[model samples]
Target: MNTDTIVAVATPAGKGGVAVVRLSGSEALAVAMGHLTASRLQPRKATFCRFTDTAGQLVDEVLATWFPAPHSYTGEEMVEISCHGSPYVQQEVVAELIASGARLAEPGEFTLRAFANGKLDLSQAEAVADLIDSATPAQHRLAVSQLRGGYANELKRLRQQLLDLTSLLELELDFSQEDVEFADRCTMLDTVAQLQSRVQSLLGSFSTGNALKQGVPVAILGRANAGKSTLLNALLGDDRAIVSPIAGTTRDTIEETMTIDGITFRFIDTAGLSQSDDELEALGFARSIKAAQQATILLFVRSVTIPFNAYATDDIAYFTDQCDMSSKHLFIVHNKCDLPHESNPPGHIVSAKEGLGIDSLKASMVAAMRKDASANDGVLLTNLRHRSALQRVQEALLHVAEGLGQQMPTDLVAVDLRDAIYHLGTITGDVTNDELLGNIFSRFCVGK
Candidate 1:
């Protein structure tokens, strides 16, 4: 636990209607009271007071609140001073506290103390940073879910089951000479299989979780003069891309982001995919293919003015050969429906010029991404660190299952079980190191 008192400007930089200066640790209240005109402060109650420096010069009128030890954010005595949001005023108040002996806090130090004091676990602490950085509703919901302990609780339950299994195996090892087995081998194998399945399910959720946490990438791809840029603008509800009737107008990918129904989608309007004689146009073609390969969803736009049956099959085949479309969610968007076209066009028909069928297209995109995420109680794994740890746990469980199937020695099986438990423990800080803690918390902003 940290022993020294720390102080910082808790709110964001720059002037607002109000600014907060936070102080924590053993000397927090004392350091704050030293400059306050108030004779005394009641715990957890806000008291309006006048603040002054050592020379007894007034600084600002502030509302001071004291949070006594063990009930505060860091589980230590804490003080929060709310004052007018003047940068100079915030600086003067902090300087006064520092002069009175409270050091400026390091990045994430306050939350680090909270973790050390058992106010929150490792995952929850990480969630605090996520919540602060959340830009969209989906990200906010995910961070909130983890912060509320649902994710932690589930992990803890799995770890407890593994610990129980390990205990039984350890017991069997101790009684090896007596030729007794505390655990039924058949039941043990089933348990290990079940655990591995659950871990694998979580590992599978990483792709969707990461996409939602970050915006989902959608690449708009088609041949030259196919109205791909028009579709991009329609989806974004803005003229984000330059629309031109000339061939190869867009020579590079133009990327933009828009939030639809609380989900953020990064739309990439790529240069048309076609055989180009010019070097720069050829380079654009290459980039367009790369964008298509990277995107989670692909919008293959085609103008309705063109004969659909004449070029549809050949174009689709060419694009399929150029990029891997097996993993991507593809939509053959027949754009310019407002123009004269055939009665039965293949795939989705839309008029980007008139804004027709764009809403349905967006709905389909969201549906495709949300389909896999709607399962497993919606407990998506968004952290790469957690995914990596769960992967190791999965591997360890696999080794345990293999050893039991091969009738390996009890001691060897026990070792693998312990390995699985350790990795699982790392996720929630049941097992952690100073280096890991420092790395995770350092990313947090100071005063948090």
Candidate 2:
């Protein structure tokens, strides 16, 4: 545990109704009391008081609460002061605390301390940042679940199972010459297979879980003046993108996010792809093609004004072929449906100008996401770090399985099993280094 006390303004900067300044560590209570005019500070109880500077000049009236070591946020002595939310007042209070020996906290230092004090595991510590940064309801729910031991609990169980197997394999090596097999070879193979399946399943859910945590990317593609921007404006119910009758008006991709049915979609309206002589427009066209390929869903917009034959060009064919529609959602949309049209085709027809079929388009997008998202499953693996670790676990188990199939030496099998166990321990933080902890916690806000 760190011996030096830390202080920072807990709330956002600027004037508001109230601001909270927090201190944590060995001398947190003493530092807070230095500026507070109160006879006694009680633990977990709010006490009204006056805050004063070193010269004995009153700074502001405030409420102070104290939490002693082993019970506070950092599992150390802590103090929180709430006062009028003026930038000047907050700064003055923090400055006074610094003079009283509390140092300003580094970004994420508070939460880092919490992790060191055994208040949370590495995965749970990362979730604290996720919960703070969540922009949508779905994200909030996912983060909350993670913070409340969502995948961490599962990871612990899985790690223990692997540890047990490694122990048995290592024990078998002790009686190698005697040929006394404590662990049955056939049953051991079966148990390893089951654990491998579970690890693979979690790895498979990474794409969908990550998309939910970070908004899903949807690329909008079409030719010049094909109503791509118009469709974007209509879907967002605002003039978010520039729409014009002129061709090649949108020379670059314009991205925006909107939540529908609690699912957030990042719509990237790329420059219209067509034969363009302009250098900038041509570069943008290349970007459009790349964006379409990477998107989770491709929204292909076509103005009814353009004949169907126009979409049959080589560029369109190349784009469609490059996109794996089987794995990705593809929405073929016919825009400007307000005009008279022919018989209904398989694709959705919409009038961006009149907002026709926009609702159904949104509904389709949500339905596609819902089909992919695992809602009620035990835990979704959202973090790429966890996914990579699981992948390593899978690779090591594969080696172990191969060795078992070949009837390899017991020591060789034990080596692979220990490798698998080491990788699994990294996920729940049973095995970690300072560098990994620093990288994860550095993204958090100061005074977390």
Candidate 3:
């Protein structure tokens, strides 16, 4: 939006088949024309030319593409030079671009300008990052839907609906003394109910989406020789954790990440939970307790051989006492499925050594991951900030429902509805602060 020329290397920094150096602004064509050693060129057309340095020395032979103003990205003239993959060529081309007229762009500066020029909205701009960082098929689908305007469409419709309800409430406030009705009570109730349901549904996707982006953290916890570490290595299909007949062989927590059915899981293998007189073992017990508190799911492991914790009352007292029932999901895993199934955990039975029943364990993990959000939906809320803001909006809408059902003053109901609408708008940056805007835009790499 500043109208000054911007330049950046659009391609990755390292060696590639070819590298792209990009420029955007009113002077973009002029800068490109001079560097490409051409007198003139057509817009949106690719031109083969020689790129030169300021001293008029030939740097590289490359292809340049120009896109003219108002119809291009950033709503301005844009040009890109495809040069040799050599780092020297890329650097020289970018240097000449800055020397000729363009300024080096900040991280995400190109996309920020495009947003300012109305080339893309806030949500669409955000999708650019999501698309870049996407690792799985589901993540790609969400980003593409958002980039294609699916989320923006839904949010816009919800905002307009809130506006209509508020307009009626305002009208009723104006006619308060005469006892004339502008907003029908029944109609308002139906609208509020419908909106509350939609917002809450959308809110549901955050937990699943975020967990998909960051591997779901599950902790394996149990007392000595309960086969917790053995289960971990078997689940990961590797000897990631040490196994032995000796009790307390694992003195520290070990972690490994893997993707199952496109969902990443971080398995934290904890030390044997035992009241040991050994100083090091005692320290390990402390670390396991810390991890247990932070874990998303607690795998209370037991062996078919041991069948139960030997020191359960003394060693596994944390689960029985300060366990967060709601925050942490619990999964009881019975290890040593290689032998005849024995009486053990009430939930799941598996052998980490043979990978027996591991598929069921993964299924159970994914089901627990979906507890807060449905991954089957088309649109999802992945950002935590948006979730928190939307939660506030949801609470305000509840207040609105309370006010309307109690036959409260029209002005009071209008205020609550307006507050809810404002919070919802904040999620999409329709109502946002400069600091938050800075944080959001700062994540982008230049030349988007």
Candidate 4:
């Protein structure tokens, strides 16, 4: 396709070590040559140049590099101008390119063009955004692996197997009138089972993948003056929430996502749980209960010296009387071991003020979530879009298999199989719509 040339400030704006202006499309080299004064240009080779306007106005001295089509990042003729990192210089360069017929690129338009030109598959393209937005080291590592063909290779192999099975079945259909047996029924059944198992394994990964992508929600719950806020600051290694000796200090939930040993955790500091008849305080307590329910893990903070409360000791009665039993994913934490206060006897002893037991608590939390991650290992259904698409494909495949087992008309089975194939193709852009593409790529940052 003869796409129009596009240009943009490829490097981050403002003063830096170096600024890069990228041009891609049919006229990339022409635009570069017109603006940049280079003695001779060689593919993949850097050249010293003096950029100038058409009116022979001096622009700036810079480094120019060109990459030919089918060998470039976007699989198009590409040029990169490395100039001094100054906003004025960058703006001047972009203006010169725009004046020379290259249009300013939109957010992710470069990558979008790459996809349209068949330079990258849909999954690898998505991984580009994931790589940029990664919050933790582990996340960045995983995204990099996926982008470099870890996940893509796996999906490709599975899809190829499914395609081969479908091809064999379709071939068998050709001699249906002659009562010929081209493919064995046992083989077909075994293949279906294998694909189903693979899909299920991927489905199991959604929980951990989601948790890894979006940090796990953990709510801290305890009575007023129970050192809940203090505990939060200790765990975060910073004072995020205001701490005071007064009761009902925290009015609303304070949320922060922090990583401890590569695992990301979203700690929610709920209003101190207490017996308050005040309508607003009652509402805060109610919100705490709600958090306890929504949370995957609950940190029930209390003083180490004080005896257990009715809610903590009478576990069955607490479940029966106040909070939902299913909602309580309980972890009893004894905060303020160094202070003189009433609290449950040191279960997992801690003094948030002294930063004691913080490491053990973190280790315990990691162990619990690690158990969750390991239980459903290797089968990571990370993308919700992929999961839903696969689910629909699974249903269509089941319909085809059921129709085959019933010995229905071959046309019916064939139609179901084609529909399933189409559904599967959507994962890699074979069957996709503009709206879906737009909604996805729009979330990407402009410089991407």
Cα error, candidate 3, residue 388 (Å): 2.0
Predicted candidate 1 versus true structure: per-residue lDDT over 1-448, tens digit per residue: 5679999999999999899999999999999999999999999999999999999999999999999999999999999999999999999999999999999999999999998898998999999999999998988988988898457777877898999999999888788899998888999999999888888877877777788889888989888889999899999899888999999999999999988877888899998866669899999888888887778788888888888787866877766676666546788999888988877455788999899999999998888877756766788888999999999999899999999999999999999999999999888888999899989999999889
The positional error of residue 208 in candidate 3, measured at the CA in angstroms, is 1.5
Q: Which pairs clash inside model 3?
A: 44-66, 108-444
Question: What ranges in model 2 sit over 4 Å off?
Answer: 54-56, 223-225, 240-251, 272-282, 303-317, 324-327, 375-378
Checking candidate 2 for backbone clashes, the offending pairs are none
Each prediction's whole-model lDDT (CA): 0.89, 0.86, 0.80, 0.77
| Candidate 3 local distance difference test against the native | 0.80
lDDT of 2 by residue, 43-155 (tens): 89999999999999999999999998899888889999998999999999999999999999988898888888889888888889999999898798778878885577778
TM-score per prediction, in order, is: 0.93, 0.88, 0.86, 0.85
Model 2 TM-score, 2 decimals: 0.88
Angstrom error at residue 40, model 1: 2.5
* Residue pairs of candidate 4 with colliding backbone atoms: 205-380, 306-342, 306-343
Over 4 Å off in model 4, which ranges?
A: 222-226, 242-251, 271-282, 302-310, 313-330, 336-347, 367-379, 397-410
Candidate number of the best lDDT: 1
Winner by TM-score between candidate 4 and candidate 1: 1
Q: Per-residue lDDT for 160-229 in model 4, tens only?
A: 8778777776776787788776766666667776777776666666656676678877888877888889
